[model samples]
Target: MPRIAYFGPQGTFTEQAARTFGDADLVAVETVPLVLAAVRSGEVDSGCVPIENSVGGAVTATMDALAEDEPLIAVAECVLPVRFSILVRPGTRAEDVKTVASHPHALTQVHDWIAANLPNATPVASTSTSSAAVLVQDGEFDAAVCAPVAVTHYSLETLATDVADVDNAVTRFLLVSRPTRVPEPTGADRTSLAVVIAHAEPGSLASTLSELALRGINLTRIESRPLRGQIGEYRFYLDLDGHIGEERVAGALAALHRNSNQVRFLGSYPKADQSPSVPSAKNTDDDYQAARDWVRRMREGR
Candidate 1:
């Protein structure tokens, strides 16, 4: 049985994702680094950690950890819609609430709601929304912005539900493991890579990006993070729209690796929200096979 570690105290969204991941023994850890460490040290078969939130943007800790020297591979991705509730200890009325506590990113997601409802209440940051619920249960805070599942775990009541400022708020989580082998293509897949520029000069960044654009590889995301010990130097993290098994994706990455200072492959995994197959004119399996067949026929004639 696979042992999985997740960022948790029992009621976190990471825990929610893990529960739905599979039939495995799950361990709850207190932080993202700990979850990653567990997988790297072989304490667990794999671990799950949030990589990005639609409302809060990228979770830098997860990204930086993957970029480190250890070389962890993201084997899969899970996306969950996040809805934070205003939870209070049983019998604690909304009128009695004077302070709000939750994860910093959670607080940002419900910014407008807190401003309109708890205008005078001070907002506090916790390790996670679940931890905030724990504090509220222990009488440390008046109310907590947390998941609905936490209310039962912490013996709290929900004063309001779906408190996120945006209705479409979602978080993307990654199942990371020590580098072994990349998962096979699932037709619809995503490939992640870290690219460091060979030089710091004007158009250098654009030159790196052109390699993907020139190949018609659609990029889903691209972000830059400064490299440690190298002043003013940065590395780019990118998500492209195909599997490493595909010809175009492989060729583009090969070219990128040759031109860039360094390229680290995070992993190519099945995309969680892949759309149903839709026919396209640009590229398809049949087209690739037909082109290959034409080349084979020419070789035979020669």
Candidate 2:
């Protein structure tokens, strides 16, 4: 069994996610940065880091580490469903709640719930969701927005149930490993690659993307970031369906090769894991908006 690392503090949802994907041999770390560092250091065979949450959109820290300084390649995925509860001192009541604290991501997930129910209460951010629970238990705050597991660990009360405002929210976690020489595709694969085009040349972007369309390949995602040492130049990072070994994918890449000055393939791997459902009316809208409002109150209260 391979060892995997993820954000942890014993009972965090990140730890649960690691255990879900890693079986019983998972190691829990403190931060997304540490998870990436552990993989780069080869201390673990792989690491799992949350990439995006339905509520929060993207985990910007994880994206920056994967995009900027690291050579880690995404290998597998874990889609973890998030359900949040408000925990507070054993005797705390809804009327007595003043401020709520939780990890930024956790706080964001349950933002809607807090906004509607805790109108006057504030939300605070802690190092981890579990820590937020702990702080809420010890501090004077009325409550903490945390996981159910954390509520049990902290011996706090769940002032509200499923207050998260959304029933089907999920976070996508990527299992990354040291870059592989050639990745073997499991069915339903996605390829991730980075390319640099002539900054001043005409039709450069067109020529690159057109090849994929011409070959009937689906361009799933296209993102751009600055190329190192060049302020004006940017590198395009893409995720598309089809493996490099496939003829159409190969030919399109070849066409891109001829059209662009240079291309660096990060890796061709699995598509991201995400929920399968129509966007909930409240989830993308109400749930997220509510969560944002609650987080604003919490941050402002401090």
The number of the candidate with the highest lDDT is: 1
lDDT (Cα atoms) of all candidates against the true structure: 0.83, 0.72
TM-score of each: 0.86, 0.73
Q: What tens digits encode model 2's per-residue C-alpha lDDT throughout 104-216? A: 87787777777877888888878877877777767856787765666656777878756565788888777888988656555456666678865788788887888776656
- Top-TM-score candidate index: 1
Span of ten consecutive residues with least summed lDDT in model 1: 275-284
Query: What is candidate 2's CA lDDT for residue 145?
Result: 72
For residues 116-201, what per-residue lDDT tens digits would candidate 1 score against the true structure? 88766789999888889989988999899987667667678888987778888889999989998776778878889988863456
Give every collision pair in model 1. none
- What local lDDT score does residue 224 receive in model 2, on the 0 to 100 scale? 76
